[model samples]
Target: MRKAGWNPIWKWLAIIAMIFLLAPLAIALLNGPGGSSGLYPSPNAYETISNASRSITRLPFDYDTSDDVEMLKEYVESNREALSEIDKALTQQSRVPLDYTVPLDELLNASGTVRLPMRLLIVQARVAELEENPGAAADVYAKMSVLSPKLATGGLLVHVMIASAYETMALEKLIELTPRLSAVEKKRVLSVLTTNARKPIDFDLVRERESDYCKHEHGTVRGSILLWSGSALVDQQVDRAIETDDELLRLRDEAIDLLGS
Candidate 1:
């Protein structure tokens, strides 16, 4: 039987709830140009990542093919200049906590698009992994969580696609590297995650039907475990994260079986 929480209304809410974090900066950009550019990653940067992602023949979700890996490497190598631009842009931004609020509709219709730095950082992290540099890879992923503080380690398509497949991949890489990370590195990872974890879905918000959020918490648990299969550090954290979601427990054994854990 399907989990009780996996109903249509909750599922619909899950899709839009996560976008709440972006609303403030989105409206800021729409209203004026001052400081907004620094708050969000440049459109050019996301374009670079998106263009490179498209260079691969397979879609972002496809990871089983050796060819796909090679394609990713090629894309990363050819985009050094673009990545440099992203690095410089990130260096210019202040990492202070931003506070602002506007109605949900105002954000939904905000002009232009500003992707989170997580998009570019994900590609950078993957390149680091390809270069056999785990430390660099971990650092890149850590920056992602810092850039987008509202993203949580949840939902396969819902949360992962909040930016791109790169977002999801970065989270997975972070989890996989947890056991080998140093004390300071572990602290950074934990700090960013704890700071950015998403709030529980509110049923009243769902009933209003004016705002929306995604809610595939089970997918979050399964995908997280599959990514962190070999790491004791991450397993403990993932266990704790999913323990709060009752539905995830019902699906845990099946997820483990599917991932061959």
Candidate 2:
């Protein structure tokens, strides 16, 4: 069921976002270099894109290790042409609606696997912010949001991304800059989080199944991260910031409360 403020346009945005986050992973998993016949076309291109994405996603975390960085650099350097081709393919794919329906068992098994890329991107964006490239970091996050338009309510990944972005972006610079901006801008930034604070997503009983995919050891990490990050972001940043700014406190509280009622 759709939420009250659910925008139809966002549904399209969500599909594009999903393609950006998943197409490569899909390709890689289905048709790696040694992959035989697979469901999707263009296995070679997909494999290249997948390898590069994995490297890029892991790059931020393993930055302190020289060997890891070198391997990533080599992968990127060798795959430049393949990367460009796949990037174009993804952009083209984004224009079309994704057909998410699959055999039930397949969908359930794939759900846990599908979320890994988004998690990687979230970490990538956070690391980008830490590196002081807020623009690039925001771009990474914008892609993440575009992929999950229902992010506000659909699942754990969105919640974590929102909280991490808010804490990293909001507490660091956005809060400081808030005093200088107009009321409207402040409201807009705060409003981005309102959906997630309320309207939690229904994952179609995926969370309740006794299958391996539903287990915490395998499946629930995405949602767990979301719960932890969102709670922490709200507690540390939103709650703390309002302590110093009465006007902001009111606005933030109202945004969250309105969503609940």
Candidate 3:
């Protein structure tokens, strides 16, 4: 018997395999590079904030108790310079450009460093209240309201979650403080609340940035494939985050109305 010629079906199978293999590459090419668009504000404030966060003194004590108030006062006073830098960083118009392409440890370190400052802000606010400085306390809460959103701006989902927590803390403080604030301070605080409620976290941008980081870290073709496969899960997460944010905003609106009243 003559040797069988190469099978036509085998040829067609090889062609299909090639198409399947090249599909990702074609998709990646069309999509272009991953990572941040570099449109973020210049002179990134991340380093300043991170450095300040590290320098803050951490005191382990119940913030609620009057006994800890003195310690909290000392903590704030001790970290005065650091807190000042942080305040400047947060208040500046510049963006906190978080380099998402960094290693996981580095990213975690960056995210972790910020919490101390946040905690310190709470302490400072408490001290302000204890000192009968409602205006000062109001300022602290307002700063927190501003700072909370900044924490997640241009950051990943982790940052978004952290920001949400910060915002929650700020909102809670606002609710408690609104009754005590002077009319002028209440109006100012109300303005901040309105601004934050109007512009909730941009989960879609977070998703896009995260997708870009994945593509950058794990070659475009593989990353695109991974992101595409995981898109549904990511979207679900985004939806949940948006819902949570909406509820937070609703609570904020109620607070605004109460303050306005």
Clash count, one per candidate: 11, 1, 0
Tens-digit lDDT string for candidate 2 (1-261): 966875789988999999889966664454332211114433332233334444443334453233443454454455455335434433322111112333445543433332434445445445554555555444444343333322212223323334333334333333333444445544454455542332223333212221222222332444344435555654554334334334333444543343223
lDDT of 3 by residue, 45-89 (tens): 566677787787665568645546677788788989988887677
Q: What stretches of model 3 exceed 4 Å from their correct place?
A: 1-7, 31-35, 61-66, 131-134, 191-198
At residue 123, what lDDT does model 1 achieve?
58
Please give the distance, in angstroms, between residue 244's alpha carbon in candidate 1 and its true position after superposition.
11
Task: Please give each candidate's TM-score.
Answer: 0.35, 0.29, 0.83
Worst 10 residues of 1 by lDDT: 206-215
**Model 2 misplacement above 4 A:** 1-104, 150-261
lDDT of each candidate versus the true structure: 0.42, 0.39, 0.75
Considering lDDT, where higher is better, how would the candidates rank from best to worst? 3, 1, 2
Alpha-carbon shift of residue 76 in model 1 (angstroms): 3.4
